[model samples]
Target: MLDATLKAQLKAYLVHVRQPVELVASLDDDAKSNDTWELLNEIAELHPDVSAVRADDDQRRPSFLIRRVGTEVGVRFAGIPLGHEFTSLVLALLQVGGHPPKLSEEVLTAIRELPGDYSFETYFSLTCQNCPDLVQALNTMSVINPRIRHISIEGGLFREEIEARQIMSVPAVYLNGEPFAQGRMDVEQILAKLDTGAEARAAEKIAAKEPFDVLVVGGGPAGAAAAIYAARKGIHTGVVTERFGGQVLDTMAIENFISVQHTEGPKLVAQLEAHVAEYGVDVMALQRAQALVPSRSPGGLHELYLASGATLKARTVILSTGARWRSLGVPGEDAYRNKGVTYCPHCDGPLFKGKRVAVIGGGNSGVEAAIDLAGIVAHVTLLEFGDQLRADAVLQRKLRSLPNVTVLLNAQTTEVEGDGNKVTGLTYKDRTTGVVHSMGLEGVFVQIGLIPNTDWLRDTVALSTCGEIEVDQHGRTSVAGIFAAGDATTTPFKQIVIAMGEGSKASLAAFDHLIRLPAAGEAVAA
Candidate 1:
């Protein structure tokens, strides 16, 4: 289902396979197993150096093994690779055969020093853009160290295991049968968890006399830009974030970032991080910001409390916490998410080309999604919970202009119906008549709304009715010395380019705010 351009890229990538790889499918008479077998066969046909084989034993029927021609890489894919995860399967093929390991001496040393044998079972879905990265990282680690056995389990194919583990999200990794991490994890992050010597050291509780000139919260695109700009001014800059790449890490194809024709989320995030690291910014990753409280002293230093019981004091703070899509709480919505139900049409819509799909919600986003999908998919079903669409008249008119688009008003999506492997249909009810209906489709896109990450701000700053932080034109919040940007603020049209610009603006504004303050220790000298 790849486009011409993507197919060309894949072919070029496949040409570098040094040794032949074998896909041994151990499949039963199930839909997921059959799908996996078919996809493997297709992949084998695509690459000259790859071939598929069937196993006679029932013990390993549903599972597939990918190993180099002579060497034993011990990589296992538990299900079919589809959606965004297809990239991971391709990468695994490249890395397994003749491609040198991409690791630093320090990381290699840590991997070799790992004490005992551990099996990493990572739960993932085909549509999850973030899962592939973690799976690839873990698999690479397994290749590096023989003691580590890693398997990428397709969550949709293993529902019983999912129920046993209570895996609600993709990329849920477990090391030695215990939970390791929940989201995308870079090599450094994973090694930190594995190597005891690399674990974070405890710091003694002592109130700091010195303060940072600027502190950027949230390590998303906005925070990365803010930190870069702030550090370039030669000021003491520090940034604390739960994850280095916020929502962007979960994104897949990003074709609209300006100048870049094609780039995945992790690739762009790596570049953003590299740019920020070029400066003198102290980035504290995997640190959650608990509360933002102003210092009791007269100098107006703001203290940011972290979940680890540490406080970060700064002269100015920039909020770029970002936002997440509002989810449908109905049954199978979470289970089938990233399987056949997706959130980003721009990212995952192309994967379902020539297949029927539905977009939930009646707002501008839903109509726009329907309009976008109608061109690619065989059919587009737009279901709105409201009596009428809340989209602009122009967008509504354009949506109606599409030949394959069908609009359903006052439709309440009750459940996302799906087979054990992928989405098959959706069940909804008519709000006016209370009549329930079902429609067969391959994908469901939830376009309701985005929930900002400003709830943790509490009553400290001015907030909108929907909990979005209120900020002025210069990215300055109602409270001086504190600024907000990106989806966390009242910024219209939440896009990466806009967030980067806003972050730059906020940094310059913070610098302006700092220049007006008394010189460091000048008041004390007085």
Candidate 2:
């Protein structure tokens, strides 16, 4: 069944249409034999304009295309509408129905006058929900203009294509057959790229530039630390980041970071930036590193290309891209995000102080959140989907000692209960008994795990099976000149203190490499 919220949004698209909307469910052979066919027939009969067409017969195939006419929207399920082909369906619908929200005159004019056709093909896995918004934003632009086309290929189904393209991560976008951008991009950036045509030319020019003494790939805590240290050593260093703060900006507060008893994530990031800036480190914000090209030089100088077509050469690179929160894929979880659903206990726990809350997961993060919340909240229900808590023995004992913490083992969160604005409770199923239960709570803290932001680096550096960048003790990657730190790297802990320490270490190593390099004018003496 279609979600009520999605259905309502779809209805909003039909305001200008005079003809009745038709929702056609295209069924396969299996669906025809099962009760799915009956359900489709029921829906078709209820709506006079709607039809359920079975693709079982050749004659019915024409009806599939016929129903698309005057239809403002179409939805696909089960079948793989991926790769270069998915763009066709979306374009057809947009052409037939027209844009519902409509674009501003300036945006529309800019899109129409876009000089050339630039197709961005992004390969993504279903696990990353964040990929969709990026793809959708691109598609929305594509809908408004004929020059730009966006394609999203599912990595799972199109394994061969993804492998051929050397895709290492979800939400990797390629522009005009070349790797153009990665990660999430805002609408304005997309428009600027489409309008300027400078990024494409810059990529070619950057390939010919000299490498830098040190290149920091992210501007987060780890990267900023590395940049400051490297710059202080008088090494020609540059920091390129999609955003200045990286994941630290997403955080609410930092209580565990040493020296600073308590600080917000953004505030901490600002301090790091200030420190780096004081050292005269070259910082590039709102820019993403497109690729890392290794130099033939023995001393480890490498070329770092940016999405905007700019390039920086460096003797050593420090990647402190950091990690993203792992989400619970259960229903209604997204609907209550920021309202009553939160990922960071340090960020949102205080809000639920003196109120009942549920912490989900069996790992160390889950146990830690529960133990911490026990001190502040009225009661904490620790729901572990595993047989037992996977935290360390000492932490498990501490959790058990807490009077207000209740541990529920082998419990899986099936759905998040919400009251439109905030979370009200949660529904879960017992793995052992097959019994389902619901509990009321003021908030839900998800502590499942963290996914390293190394997807974009797969083509440039080595990554572990767990998606972490593989690095040596000194924060050097398998590939020379490229270093990694923080949670994104193959470090033991995901703590801020550890990340900062690793950043410092990587910076020192980078500085050492820079000092050994030939001086600017003396290099040609050889």
How do the predictions measure up, each by TM-score?
Answer: 0.71, 0.52
Backbone collisions counted per model: 3, 5
Task: Compose the digit string of candidate 1's lDDT tens values, residues 55-94.
Answer: 8775434788787767667588887666667777778777
Question: Scored by CA lDDT, what does every candidate get?
Answer: 0.81, 0.68
lDDT of 1 at 239: 80
Q: In terms of TM-score, how similar is model 1 to the real structure? A: 0.71
Q: List candidate 2 segments past 4 Å from native.
A: 1-211, 243-267, 296-301, 305-311, 345-357, 362-380, 390-405, 417-425, 434-442, 515-526
Measured with C-alpha atoms, the lDDT of residue 247 in candidate 2 is 74
Q: How far out, in Å, is residue 433 in model 2?
A: 3.7
Name the 10 consecutive residues with the lowest summed lDDT in model 2. 58-67
